[model samples]
Target: MSQWQQPGDRRTRGRVLRWNLAGWILFGLLPQAVAVLDASPARRYWLLGLLVLIALCHTVVVNRPDNPLLRHGTYLHLLALVLGSTAYLMDGGAAFYVVSLPQFWLFTRAPRDAITLSGAAAALTVFGGTLHQGWSPQFLTGNVISTVVACVAGAGLGLWVHHFVVRSNERQEQLTAALALTQKELAAAYQQQGAAQERERLAREIHDTLAQGFASIVVLAEAARAAAVNDPVRCAEQLTSIEQTARENLAEARVLVGSAPESGVAAGSLAITLRRTLDRFAQDTGLTVTAELPDVDLDQRTRVALLRCTQESLANVRKHSGASTVGVVLTELAGGVELEITDDGCGFVVEDSRGYGLDGMRRRLAELDGELSVISSLGDGTRVLASLPTHSQDRA
Candidate 1:
């Protein structure tokens, strides 16, 4: 799965850099205009320095959002403004302008510090201009206008910058929320898929174990009834046989519900664990489960499901298959698992009976993307075959 990340991080960084780029572009333009108009080398040199300084501000704002740089950058901008204004005054220019770097107060991380530092900057500029301009009437007039204009622009522009950044921050937050919801939805989908697979496995267990058992019970009861009408002594013997058959079915049902007979096993696949279960099963009923050698890696959950299927098959054979031998064949393939249960017993027509045991097996196989087939006759042996797809197997 792809790892999760904050969606807003990229948007915030890109948007902030773009905004500062526009500011630096305007800063660059104004100095080049000063260098072009009514030029002297001393003033041109001052404008060239302003151009370089503004370019540096772009780099600083683009790379850093910390308070100190914002403070220092703001101070540099104000000092550059004062130098530009002084250059214009010396050339007897009619008007002077500062780019008003205090607009940064609203967008930067440390706005209050930007504001405090900007105020100090404006004070130093006004103080220096007043003392150096020699207290003349023209100096007094320029001082008043400069103070009023700087205060008005800083107050109004600071509020506007704050409002714009707040909007950007809100957009960032929304992006983050959307990403979180997407991740949660993906997690829920995986959980549902796991649940569906587990349900299918349980259904198969019911078919292989419980369905087959019920079928035997039906056959045993029918046999006893038919014999009872002809011979009373034989009827008593059949009843005794049916009792054992019913007891085996009850055991199969218990194991189907996960109450397997406590045969101690450290752990492994369903096939491996079932060998141990079948050993105990053989001890209880004197029926053997035989398998040819094969290798497969089965997860624990699959081991239990397969064991239940084996348990149910063995129970049915012990109760109803009037045979001296029982055989179990397990095969492993490159991409799947297969199990075959065979018996040389009084087989019955599979097509004639829609037993619960068969139905359960069919459902379980469906879950595993597998299939079950039964081949048998009234006189010959019975063969039960089931195959499961590898991809459908749950590793859990």
Candidate 2:
């Protein structure tokens, strides 16, 4: 395949070089040939000299469109044409000689100047030709008319070609710019899609592991509440059970987050993340941390939702509510998951909240088709309740 591609590339390069070379040769060398063919021995030296001068002007020096040197090049080319035409005219009855050869320069060099150069050369050719052919009114008049006709027609044609080339170049530039922009947009779109896929994967992991563990914690916490009066020892057992549920769920979360097990970073799992967050909150503000979790099957999405919601609510409690004890609850409802965070803090009115905590909670819940409820008042405790959607909930 590489060999085939190499040959194809070389062929294309060869074709482009050939086209450029053909254009240069037709414009530069053709005039020399005309001078050689038309001039006799007496005029040949002058004609050949002029042709050589044109070749020299165009050959060794590079022609810059804006530099004064271009004017010199144009002058050299036209002077050569005029001198060559004069040589032809000095011969007998040379009527057809005109600036025809010089006009070819317009296509090869600056197309914009083609009309003026070709017209001037044609006019001079007619002048030289008419004088040489015998300046009788009838012949001179006819030749001048023909020369004018040819010059006008050729100038119009050259201008059309110049406009076409300029437009083609402009269009090619636009298409190249558009293609680059399109590739950039396509790359951005692919990155966005990859991010979305990662988010979905995280959600699925949370639903599979942490959600179930939180549900089990809620059951055990509630059991502890019920058994507290009957048997304090069993209540202690239930607390132990909830603690175990939390630890196991956290381990699962760590795996989902891609943290290596050996280093023990846990990458924000329940074991590492929740404990650190709770410890910091308790240490910073004199509020005690209370957690109740149970063992159960939890979906990856449900676990993520519950954990994030809990983290946000507790942070808000620490920052906004001057609470003594913040309660964290994870429970399984009849057919869905539930998380409740209650802080015995100086709460503000929910309607007048200037914080992003509730708003962000609402947004996150909306994605899971969940519902959020907040109850709080000035000087009263704040309570946050989140109810996850059932499997039947509309995801779209």
User: Each model's TM-score, in the order given?
Assistant: 0.45, 0.46
Task: Evaluate all candidate structures by whole-model CA lDDT and list the values in order.
Answer: 0.59, 0.61
Candidate 1 residue spans exceeding 4 A from truth: 1-63, 69-87, 90-172, 185-310, 319-339, 343-370, 376-382, 388-396
Candidate 1 residue-wise lDDT, 161-241, digit = tens: 566666767777798899899889989988998888777655665456556556655655676688787877766765665
Candidate 2 matches the true fold with a TM-score of 0.46
lDDT, candidate 1, equals 0.59
- Among all candidates shown, the one with the greatest TM-score: 2
Query: 42-96, model 2: which lDDT tens digit per residue?
Result: 5667655655665455443323224453553455356536543653445321233
In TM-score terms, candidate 1 sits at: 0.45
